[model samples]
Target: MSGSALKPATELARGNSVRTPNESAEYRRAREQLLAEEIELRRHIERVAELRRALPPGGVVTKNYEFEGEGGKATLSDLFGNKQTLVIYSYMFGPAREQPCPMCTSFMGTWEGKLPDVEQRVAFVFVARSPIARLIAAKKARGWTQHRIYSDASGDYTRDYVSATDADAPGYNVFTRRDGSIRHFWAGEMGPSTADPGQDPRGAPDFDPLWTILDTTPEGRGKDWYPRLSY
Candidate 1:
C-alpha cells in the first residue's frame, strides 16, 4: 500500500529496503555521537602524551653503584654497555621474596622477544635487587640471553631511581644526557596497577590494548599464565 509496506523478503535481502526519514536521521545521530566519542578519546591521548613530554628533567645519581655482570664486576654505566640512553626496569626478584613476581615475569617475557628491536633505538636492561649469582641463575633459567641483565645487590641504584623504597617493585626508569650531565626522564612503578583496570572490581574502565588483545581469544592469557624459567 504505502512505500513503507515493502515485502519482508525484500527488506531482509537488501538491508536498506525501507527506512523512514526519521530512522535515517536517528542512525546519523548515533553515528555522530560515536564519532564525537572517538575524537574526544584521541584528544585525551594527545593530552597524556603532552604531559609525558612536559615532565621536568630529573636529578642524576652522582655515586656509582656496583653490579655483577656475566663478565664479572661492573658499574652502573656498564649496564648502559656504551649505549647513549639506558632504560632500566626494576624487577621484583629479591632474596627474601616468596617467588619472582608473575606480572613482572610476564612483562619480561614480552621484552625478551622485543629486546632486539628496542636495542636499535635505546639500550634496555633489567635490574634486580638480588645477588649477582642469584640474578644470573634466574636469567639463565628463564632463557633471557638476548638482553643485558644485572643485579643491584645493594639497593643504592634502585633507591636513586625511586623504583624501590627499601623494597623493590616492578618499575621502569629512563635516563638520558642533557648537556654534560645525566638526567632522569621518566619512571613508572605502578604501571601494573595502572594497566589492569579490571582489578578495580567496581566499574571496569576500557581495558588496556595489551590486555584486550590477549582477551580476544578463547584460551586467553589465563590467570595461571606465568613465565617459567624452563619451558
Candidate 2:
C-alpha cells in the first residue's frame, strides 16, 4: 500500500478507538447548540403571536348588512348571535366562480370538525360574497352541517373588515370586543405559509398540531393530499 494509504482493517481499528472525555464534551456542546437554535425558533414564533395580539382595533361597522340564514333573514349582529367574540373566515366562493375554491373547502372541512369545540369558546362562521342561497347549497353539497354559514351578498361586511379585494378576495379575520366596541383582532390571506405546492391542501400552516402529529409517522401523510367531502 502507498505510504498515505491505509487498508480497510487498519482504518477500522483506528475508527473503533474510544473517545476521550474532552471529545465527549465537545459532542455535547454541539448538541447544546442545536437545542439552543430550536429554543430560539420557538421564541421567535411566540413573538409573532404577541404582535398579533397587540394589533390596534380597526374601522367600525357603520352599515349593517343582511344575510339569509337557516331560520330567515339575519344581520351582521346575527352572526355574533349573543356571543362576545366572533371569527369570520372569508371564503373565496362568489357568484361567478365555477366552483368553491379547493383550498377554502379544505379549511372549511377542518373548521367543520372543530365547530363544536370552537363554539364552546367563541362564535365562528364562514362568510362568502355569494348570495345566501348559493352559499347554503354549496355547504349542503359538502355535507358541512355543523357550522353556521353566511353570505356577504352586499359585500359591505367583507369590505369593512378589509378581507375583501376590489372584487372579492378570500381571507380569514378575527374580531373581538373591548368596552362594548367591536374590533378587528387578526387577519390572514391565502399565501405561501397557508397554501402552496408541497403543502397541506387545507391551505393552513405546517405548524398546525394535526399536521405536526401526522408528520411523525413512517408513511408521513404522503404528498398526495386532498380534502374529502364525502368518504
Give me the candidate number with maximum lDDT: 2
- Residue pairs in collision within model 2: none
Residue lDDT tens for model 2, 1-231: 132342343344334444556567667555556555545555556666777777777666556678766667787666777787788877778889877887568667766777899898888888887887888889888888896888777777777674436356667677776577676667665565656577644533342444556766767777876555345
Q: Which lDDT value does model 2 have at 43? A: 55
Residues 1-231, model 1: lDDT tens digits: 232443443233334333446567767555556555555555566666677778887777587778766677787666666677888877889878755777567567766777899898888888887787877777777788785777777788877775436575766788875565667787653444555555422112222334546655768756655455344
Residue 150 CA displacement from its true place in model 2, Å: 0.5
- What is the RMSD of candidate 1? 10.9
RMSD of 2: 12.3
TM-score of each: 0.67, 0.66
Model 2 residue 93 CA deviation in Å: 1.1
Candidate topping TM-score: 1
| Worst lDDT 10-window in candidate 1 | 200-209
